[model samples]
Target: MSILIDGLLAILAIYLALQSLLAPRLSQSVFLFFAFGLALALAWVRLGAVDVAITEAAIAAGFLGVLFLDALRDFSSTISEKHNNTEAIQSSASRKKIKTFLLPRLAFGVGLGLFLLISLEAIWQIPQGGGLTAAAESMLPESGVEHPVTAVLLNFRAYDTWLEIGVILLGLLAIFVTGGIKIYTKPDVVAKDPLLRQVILFFTPVLFLFGAFLLYIGKSGPGGAFQAAVLWGAIGILLHLGGKPVFAMIPRWVGQLVLIMGLGFFLLMGFVFMSGGATLFEYPKAYAGTLILIVETLAAISIAAALTAIYANLNQMKEEPKENESAN
Candidate 1:
């Protein structure tokens, strides 16, 4: 029964991937991509990788879908109908030519068959059961977190997590350098609908509360700082969509401080520990768990702020044409 279930999920995932790849409309393709992510997440869950599934569902599917949908809205009006029709006709002709070419079809089929055979062989070779389970379990207590993945992320592989946080901050920096931080300050001229506003107002607090809960439970469960941070970022995006500039309400310097707090605190913690003769990022066994929690909390905050800043930059970019038009 489990094998059947896995087989079904695999088939569904493949279907979603094909749909995402073949969809012509940008909006359709984005939605299909979201569905593809969700399908893959389910596959991950069936394979018992709940943490990976959560990240895939939340960040890959939900967060990216929202981002793409927003960008699609911003550029949807720019598409020319005549150009679209011309492209459609050309694409149709090309499809016919491809169908008429038997040799090309045969070559494509042979290539696909070879690829599938190789993939199946790779899957079959994967060893059944856990690798490094004993090693991880033996060192779990020293690593700070009860969950193996959490321990690996926050303790054993701390540098990787730190660099990941740095990457998020760097993305925000790039956005800020390209577009000013005041992007969120400009008012959203198109007022959001009352129903949307009401929904956002009601859910914003709940979102933050849930995100905090996720962060707190991450040491022992599938939830983590990254998932929590994405949730908070999603809330910020929702608020923006509802015509609220939450970032603008906070002082620019304060926002910047929050954005850097995670990386700064992480570096400080590492250096302080190193000064005590411990290796960099080697949490003292006595305070390992506590330090992990503190770092994760701050990292979540910085990540949330950075992601919100990215959306704000996108919002500003979308409004540039309107500003230029008004100037004209």
Candidate 2:
């Protein structure tokens, strides 16, 4: 029964992935991509990596899904404008160009096929039932967390986790640089549906409570900082869609502090520990659990802020006017 379920999930995942890539319409592809993420999340759960599954479902299906849908809306509008200008030229040339790169397309397809075969071969060659499970289990008692995944992420591999947080901050920085630091401006038109308002009210508190619950639960279960951050970040997104724009209401300095608190505190702790003749991020066994909890809490807040900022910036972006429109 378990094997059959796994097989079904595997097939669904593969089908969704292929359809998402090959779908002719942007909206169809985006929806298919969401399906693929959910399928992949289920696969992760079946593999017993619930932490990974949660993160995958939240970030991929939830966050990235919203981003992709927004992008699709923006892209569709831009394409519509361009199509009006180039429809005649494109209509005449589209069919002629269809077969122009036949050989190159065939070669690219063949290359992809070979790559897939090579990847499968490599997977099959990997040794099974040989990993760091035994070692991790042995060290679990001293790692300051009962959950092995939490232990590995917060203690055993603290450096990598720290860098992961840094990467998220850097991604937000990149977005700011490219998009010119869009502060959340209130939309000219806000949705005033009572049902939508009710839904937002219901979910807002639920997400906040769940995010905090997940952060605390990470010490013993599948929940953690990243999962909690996604939930918290989602609250901001929900509010934005509901016309609240919570991030925009906050003072700029406060926003900056919240955004940096996680990474900054993490580095400060690392340096403090290093002063005690220990390496960076190597917490003393006596205070490890407390330190990990603090770091996780702060990291969750910072991550949530960064994610909300990214979404707000993307959501508020205005389409640049075309030359003809500008002249008019």
Q: Which stretches of candidate 2 lie over 4 Å from their true place?
A: 77-100, 188-191, 319-328
Sliding window of 10 residues with minimal summed lDDT for model 1: 183-192
User: Against the unseen true structure, what C-alpha lDDT does each candidate score?
Assistant: 0.84, 0.87
- Alpha-carbon deviation at 189 in model 2, angstroms: 4.3
Q: Residue 215 error for model 1, in Å?
A: 0.7
- TM-score on alpha carbons, each prediction: 0.85, 0.90
Cα RMSD (angstroms) for every candidate in the order listed? 3.7, 3.6
Q: Which stretches of candidate 1 lie over 4 Å from their true place?
A: 77-123, 126-130, 177-182, 186-191, 325-328
lDDT of 2 by residue, 1-328 (tens): 6899999999999999998877766788788899899999999999999999999988887799999988876775323433543664465566665455355679899999999999999999998977999999999999888999999999999988899889999999999888777668775343488887888899899999999999999999999999999999999888888888878899999999999999999999999999999998889998999999999999999999989988888887654344338888
lDDT of 1 by residue, 208-325 (tens): 9999999998999998999999989988877776677778878878988998999999999999999999998998998999999999999999999888878877777766667779
Weakest lDDT window of 10 consecutive positions for candidate 2: 76-85
User: What lDDT score is found at residue 108 in candidate 1?
Assistant: 93
lDDT of 2: 0.87
> Compared to the true structure, candidate 2 yields what TM-score?
0.90
